[model samples]
Structures are given as C-alpha cells and as structure tokens.
Target: MSGQLYLGLDLGGTKIAAGVVSGSGKLFSLVRVATPAHGVRSDLRALFDAAQATLAAARIGWPKVKAVGVGVPGAVDPRTETVWAPNLPGWKSVPLRRLLERALGRPVFIEADRNVQAMAEAWLGAGKGASDLIFLTVGTGIGAGIISSGRVVSGSRRVGGAAGWIAVTDRWQPAFARLGSLEAQAAGPTMVRAARLALRTQKRGVLARLARADRKLTGETLVRAARQGDARARRILAEAGEHLGRGVASMVALLNPELVIIGGGLAEAGDWLLAPLRRAAKKWGQPLASRQVRIMRTRLGADIGVLGAARCAMLEMEREKKSNVDFPSNQAG
Candidate 1:
C-alpha cells in the first residue's frame, strides 16, 4: 500500500481545511469550513464534516485512506493523546487523537500546527534542499519551526516553536508585558496598536490621516501608508522589523540554520520589513551567524498548513507500515 491516498486536516482559529492528497504531494479534493466558536466538540464536528466532504468529493472512503494527520494550534502530547489548545476555549487536555481516530475508524495522528508548516516548507517549500532551516511565522503570534538535517525538529514535548514567548524588552509593566514577546511587537495587531498610540498623541503623521475613526488598524493599511512615505507608519513598521530581526538573530545563534523563511500577514511589507530586520539582526545576531543565515519570505503562502498536514499523514503512514513489517503487530503501536 505504498503511496496510497491520505487525508489531512488543518484546524485553526478562523477555519478548518481538509484535503485528500496523493503520493506526489498533489491535492485531489479540498474543502474549507468556518471554525466552531463554541468548544472542542463543535470544532471537531466541523473538522470531521470537512474531511468527510473531501473524501466524498474525491470518490474515496475511509478504507482507502492509509492515514490521517491533523495540525492544531496548541500543545499536543502525542504519547498521552491530550491537547492543550487554549484558544478553543473549553479545549484543554482533550484526547484529540483518540477521538479523531475513533470517529474516522482509522489510524490518526496530530501535530502542532507550526511544526507541520515547518516540515512542509523544509520538505517541499522554499526550504527545500536545505539541511538546516527555520520557518518563522510573524502574524498574530510568532512561532518558529526548526529543521535540522533535513527533518523537522520536535522537542521533548513538541513545543519547539514558541518563539513569541521570548522576552525582548525589559522596561515593561503588566500592561506592557506582552511587548516582551517578539510577536506582540511585530505582528499585525501590534502595528494597529502603534497607530492608536500615535493617534492619541496627536502626532503629525500619515497614520492619523489614513486611519478612519471607525476602522481598525492593520498591517495592510500600515504598509500602504508607509509606502506612501507616512512618517508614523514607516517608523512603526521599521520598529517592528527591528524587533523581528532580533528574534531571528537569536534563533540563528541557537539553531545555526542555513535559511530563515518568514511568512504571515506582516511579511507583505516586503523590503520595507526586511531592510530593518536585516539591520537589527546584524546589529545583535553576532558576526558569523547573521552573516551565514539568509532570511526569505515563504513561497507557499496560506496553503502551507494544509500541505504540511498531508505530508505528515503520509510520513506517519509509511513509518507505521515499516514498523509493522519489522515487528509483530502488537509491538508496532
């Protein structure tokens, strides 16, 4: 059953996506559904529905699916089958793997969402052909994926990519505590926060003029204003780039990765973001590490999560089959 069909589920804060993948990394049928706001049960139901819909659309069934993999945005304990997904509200220590496996009546596995993304990029995206790489997603929060020796690195507990939690600033109050996180300073919401602060100070800047009273501040508008030579917007983005660069510098020092692939909403700023990032990283990232590492934006965009999930499912199925063939069935699981 080598190269058999696979199913993948990507569960996120906004939506859940499911896809049927072939051996060649080609997705046959895909579907998306709004994430359930209530709780884990609601969310799991939606995920299952999306998976089933994709399966039906592909004209396939559970028996034909060799394995299923799910990518979730929280801490996952593969050994215990429990997930500590706080964003899902009531989903803490939920046995997601068992639940999905029983529901699908097939072998199922779960991985941290960011790790899955990192793996896909390392295997098939821009990081392809690199033995050591890092994928830093600079969005609502900053998470990283470490690829070592051409494989995704999972720490003892699979919490390998919690880069946003790293402390960057010292002058912080409880209100300003979030600023310590690289993400809190560089993510899209952070740019909006900067805009609001600029507005309150009545700064003579482009941000005050572009942001309407009723609208929310976002990276897109901030970039637009910066592109048009708005001083406040340019300053905010430059500061964010510096913060992000420092974070990458730290990662490079620790992992010694050959490449750092940046993705997320803020990456749209392109050169405006990269310039300051490079400056700050070089300032703090040390002599050798910063010189050796190359930071580039992700090429896969939004499809990374889905594609990663599919790749994870395929790899797990292959490993499981090899284990079964090498040992008795009772010893494989």
Candidate 2:
C-alpha cells in the first residue's frame, strides 16, 4: 500500500514492538507487548494487536499506513518471504510475508534483525554519512550487519553477516557449531559465566558481592562491579572485548569498512569493553585498514531495530517502484 506512514514491527524473543515512522526517520506511536511463547499463531495475534495500538497511539488509521516491514531474529529469505527465526522458537521456514500480508492487508518486507539494525543506523543513526559500515551487536549472541558501497552485503544464502561464527581460537569444540567460538567465549551469557567462575576462586571481588542472595551473575552485575572498581570484573570484560576485537580485526581486513558500530546489552559496559576491543582490532587488523577505520558504540539507543525495520520497508518500496518503472507490465513486447 502507498501511504504516508510506514509500520515497523520489531519482533524479538521477549517482546514485540510496533512503531509508526515518518519517511524522514521520525518514529512515533511506539507500542510494545510481550511476545507469545506459545507459538507463531499467538505471536501473530500479539503482532496484530501491537500494530493496531501503534496506529491509534499516533492518531492514524490503516488507510494512512504504508507497507509494513518486519525485522526477524534469524535468517531471512527476501525472495521467498520466509523466515527462520531461531529466537522466536519453533519458527522454521515460516512464510511470514504471506501471513503478515493476509493479516494486515499490506505489502510486507522481511529481513534479519541484524540487517534491520544496520539499515536504521545508516539511515538516521551513527552511520549517517558513511557508505561502508559494519553494525555489530554483541548481546545474547554476536551478529553483524555489513553494508558496503551503500548496499547491504546479504550473502548468496542471506547469511553474510553471521559474525557469531567467527573463530578466535584454533581449538574447535562441537559446541562452537551452535554458538561459535567468539560467541561462546565472549557473549553476554559467557561473560556472566566467566564472572561466576572468577567468584568461585577469588572471594574478594566486588562482583561476588554485587550478585544478590541468589548469587545470580548477570551482565548488570559485571557492570556494577566494574564501576565499583572491581579489577576482576573489569579484567573479565576487557578480555572479552579483546576477543571481540580479534573478530573485528578479521572483519576490518575483509570488509575495510569506514566505521564499525557496536551495540547491544554488553556494549553498555562502555569504554571498559570498547577500549580493549579497539586495541585488539587495531593490533590485529591490517595496518592500513585499522589506521583508517573508527570503531564506536551505537547512538540509536533502544529503538534501533524498529527504526531500521521501517527504513528497510521504505527502501524496499523504492526498489519495487523502480523495478516496476524500468519494466512496465503495460508495455507491449
């Protein structure tokens, strides 16, 4: 549908966020609801409700809504309009486009969540002017969305930026098959595990003290402990950062992006995590590439995925229009 506002659905494991976005990258009428763990059927209901509430929040109706775009949490095949969203659980080769188009009565575009994040950042966030950039998210698991020459680098199989699979060590474990070496070693859960392990051997660390009665070590605990001048916690994060940097170095050498933007739950560690990452990237990256590229944290905050999904829909619409104009169906052969 051709309309003024675009509907962006950011589907995540825990929540579904719907936002009405203007063409100029202004987001409005954001509505959030819990994602249904039951199944895709229930999740679709939540998605539908979120969309309707978002439009009402912005005081807009469906007639004013443009095409819808969704950012899924796993592999996406734009051509087939199918998604394999692992985070959604039990979603395998789901025909998301057909379902959404039927439910919302609007054209739908789908992309991996990481790719959607890059789209938003490039459109209106940190990578505003850069033609080539890497958007890396280091949360539940590490993933990247790479853009080169103003185009997305979706691989032949649409898994081009699967950064979680980056190998940082020579030792290969079967577990790496699922979580990848870098992720298994440095991702949020792994970081917490490392902190807990540190607490077992060294009882003097602030981290052990910060974990409440349950002694649950979380990323927040690590951050708080590090903030309170806990060397053990800081050291653990820095080590992870260094490992992440090694991965970044490989990306830098291969992609030679102008900017490497980092975002996600773990990124909240700020300079403590990033400082080491920068060092490792520089040290391991090709000298020329490392000298020119700048690594920084994402500035888009929490709404990155939704904004990106909307921007992605806008871009898809533009491309479709161009394709139609170039090969008019009305033209006689």
Cα lDDT listed for each candidate: 0.77, 0.83
Q: Residue 108: error of model 1 in Å?
A: 1.7
How do all models score by TM-score? 0.83, 0.88
For model 1, the run of ten residues with the poorest summed lDDT: 324-333
Candidate 2's C-alpha runs over 4 A off are 1-3, 34-39, 199-210, 213-217, 324-333
lDDT, candidate 1, 25-76, per-residue tens:
7788889898885998899899999999999998887888888888887778
Q: For candidate 2, lDDT tens digit of each residue in 75-142?
A: 87755768886556678889988999998998888887788888888888889888899999887668
Candidate 2 lDDT (Cα, 0 to 1)? 0.83
Worst 10 residues of 2 by lDDT: 324-333
The pairs that clash in candidate 2 are: none
